[model samples]
Target: MDNLAAEQATDWRIDWQAPWLAALRELGQQAHGLVQAGATVASGLQYVKQAHGLLPGWQFVDQQQLPVGQAYEAFICNQRCIPTRNNLHDFFNGLIWLHWPNLKQQLNALQAGEIESQGVGAQRGRLRDSITVLDENGGLLLAPQALCDALREKRWQDLFVHQRELWAQAQFLPIGHALLEKLVQPRKAITAHVICVPMVQAPAMCTVEAADAWLSEQLRSASCNLVNKPYLPIPVLGIPGWCLQNQNFSFYDDSLVFRASRTA
Candidate 1:
């Protein structure tokens, strides 16, 4: 495809108004402008950096700027710049950096520390693997105690239908860049490794900045060992009001998508 055609094609893939993008709506709109203007990923990063006033030292450079042998995380830590590509994956990644700089920085630090101490071995080790999962396909679920319990137990009917009203007081922020890319063409089985953050009351009053702060703090704490993957499997599209088809009570009946929990 021609350059303009390819850009337009990519632009259409992103529904800026999608419910999953609610938290990122403003940044998404600004980034869409860069896409519409035909700015390359590297240049787009510069625009967002200046417009949004991102981290002082960090910048986005072309993927080619990455050396042949250096690890990606190592490069980011040593050089303070991200090796970005011209694709949706990198695009969403940049948006994540814009929205959650602290969380991204924390993950990068953990990864780099692992590489520094362990070297890039055949296996990424538990903490590094967990960090990768969070960076690529993680989510933050803010909900009441009951809602969190329903999700942990895989109680689809109770989570989505029986206690549907509870969703109004809850929020699910998609943190993984790969997850955001996949959501561009949403599917029934698109699940998120959700870290449940139980709230005393509804999180309706919470702000994006507040959420970012809280999540960053959690990752920085000593208990950040994610080896066991302390995340719940939540089929994101099934969240009430996220997908039009899910409005029907029977939407959760598909065992294929909402599988029952495995027993010991």
Candidate 2:
């Protein structure tokens, strides 16, 4: 993320006000290269000062080491890599970086290439489009397995309506703010990877393999894809209160996501 912070750190006030952006809040603007008034972004990454390499060539630099507003942009970049338990935002980003370093590098490379070639403009090319797609819709919802089953099976009444207690079991692991935002307010064609974190018996525990298997299964047939063959497709819009407001159980009263639109 090229922090276009040309002005002195003291001159500009970055938006650190997003409450739901909890993880980012923990890292602060400086970590992600926003370069707020007081903090300067990292310029030179000191390998000795960093933790073990998370990506092949990239390592986690202590947020403290980075200068607030440094003009440093590279495929293998430095970041304030904290433990996931420490902060959700950093955790997910770190996980993504680890899982798909090449993709991340490619996207960043493309974004930079676009700026160099296209400059700041109204339209963007494919790489930017892919990055934006992943940035916005490219998120996963990590919930209890039972809750995931409810969603996958399209058990709207059991999941959202009749099963009041089940709602409490739902947990959204910080995949990405955009994904979370989409959950908060759904829209058409907005798809997310679902990671069913098991909150049940040991035998049926959720594993990465299981989640990947489910994803593959769903993709194999549109009939299996919840978004494609939705028993109720309002899920395409979102989990409810996503755009208009925060995720609220109260919003369920008039929720379009689980609002039994059919005569089930």
Which 10-residue window of candidate 1 scores lowest in summed lDDT? 1-10
lDDT measured at residue 181 in model 2 versus the true structure, 0 to 100: 40
Expressed as tens digits, the lDDT of each residue in 125-179 for candidate 1 is 9989888888999988889888999998888899999999999988888899999
Residue lDDT tens for model 2, 129-175? 54555544453354456666766666655555556465455443233
For residue 198, model 1's alpha carbon misses the true position, in angstroms, by 0.8
Model 2 ranges off by over 4 Å: 1-25, 28-34, 38-56, 59-135, 167-170, 180-193, 197-250, 255-264
Clashes of 2: 13
lDDT of 1: 0.84
lDDT of each: 0.84, 0.41
Candidate 1 matches the true fold with a TM-score of: 0.93
The per-candidate count of clashes, in order, stands at: 0, 13
| Pairs of colliding residues, candidate 1 | none
